[model samples]
Target: MCERNHPMKCFLATLLVAICGLFLHPATAAEDPAALLRAADRWRVSDDSLQVETRVQVLGRDGAVEKERLYTVFVQSGHRSLVLMRSPAEAGQRVLMLGDDFWLLMPGSQRPLRITPLQKLLGDASTGDIATLSWAEDYAGTLVGEESCEGQPCWHLQLRATRAGVSYQRIELWLGKARREPLRAELYVQSDKLAKQARFVLDRPEAPTTVAEMVLRDELGTHKETRVRYLSRTPKRVPEAWMNPMFLARNPPLE
Candidate 1:
């Protein structure tokens, strides 16, 4: 018979505690929020610039396709992004985001128009949702609890916007335990009103934590949905000048 304090029993107990520790707060309770946000952000970009193309589809309440758009996106460091519409009707339209400033340049317009990040681009997806930005820099996070998402263990976190002019006032994020990837998120407006929910889609279970696709749904009446699929991700050099709002008017050529 095995004794309670036997060496094998002691080893098993210690191993159990270590296994459970991985699911609990990895960092200290006070620092878990910020640490998790940073960890998630590391897997998001992990580079100076990310050049990718996206195919965006908007669907109505009844699940019929409403509209489709394509874009070439240049996501740079310092929370800056430039989006150039590739569709025929909106080919020349470009959107630039620099820090808290957002601007849109239409085909025939001489000057760029000021826009908000929260403005809906298609279905339930906002302009901010499309741009790749650092959540750790924009929001303050607090660990809420542990929850299961899509049959996987996730760390539920509540993030509040620390800066003005952010898209959502608050966001509830569910991050994967092992990979530190965001699995789901709930965006909220003022006073805890749920504006939308987003799910991160991956190609395979073993794929990189970077999002391959995103599904956004309106939490309100219509329950419209939007799908953004990542077409490609490649290393490309982006000039610093392209991030400025004035660059929209320049319409610089992309080589």
Candidate 2:
């Protein structure tokens, strides 16, 4: 063994330790993070075209209900999505996401205002949070190694947005090791500042099928909590006209 006073040996050992910390560990380095992420995506969404009923609620400091809103989200293939405000307070309000662009149409507005994905923030959740279901489509990342999350083992992954405009620029996500279920995520904005932290709740703990709710804690301003619950999901496809921004401006009955 090298003596404690051996400067050369000690310096080499210190450099090795530092290098290891900067790179992926050998044990997890071989695993494909993209494949793992795709597996995790299955637990979040399914089917190319799907209709999801979602409810967003924000809680006050005293745990009292502050605001509640319901939205019907229709997600389709080719990076297309439409979210209709289902609640009475926001009835007739619709948001459309066509590729990297987003449009918002209020109850009586004729012209659909052009908006970016980051500009459409609903409470603590962004429009993309409600519309886009698959992260593998927009994000490319590497496995960041395993860590304990809420008394369970989780695979940690660091993801960065690949598109021009999106909700979060980077995300530190955690998924259940066994089932690859999305457990938690730390969302960052374009500036790389932590915007919010989210925890996923499953419908069934044992043999879970899908994520039932997402509980978000605000880190930017209010520091309050917002709960995004998935009320239901069904297989449905909308007409081609529905994808058109002008058609949405006409406000035809979408049912």
Best by TM-score: 2
Candidate RMSDs in Å, in order, are: 5.9, 5.8
- Which lDDT tens digits does candidate 1 get at residues 67-158? 99888888887778888888886768788888888888887676889999977766676778777557888899988877788898888889
| Cand. 2 TM to true fold | 0.87
The models' CA-based lDDT, in order, is 0.80, 0.86
Q: Model 1 scores what on Cα lDDT?
A: 0.80
Looking at candidate 2, what is the lDDT of residue 129?
Answer: 85
lDDT of 1 at 4: 75
> lDDT by residue for model 2 over 95-214, one digit each (tens)?
999999899887677899988776635578778788888888889978888889978898899999989657899999998877888999999998999999999999898778999999
**What are the runs in model 1 whose C-alpha is more than 4 Å off?**
1-31, 61-64, 207-209, 252-255
Query: Ten residues in a row with the worst lDDT in model 1?
Result: 22-31
Tell me how candidate 2 scores on lDDT.
0.86
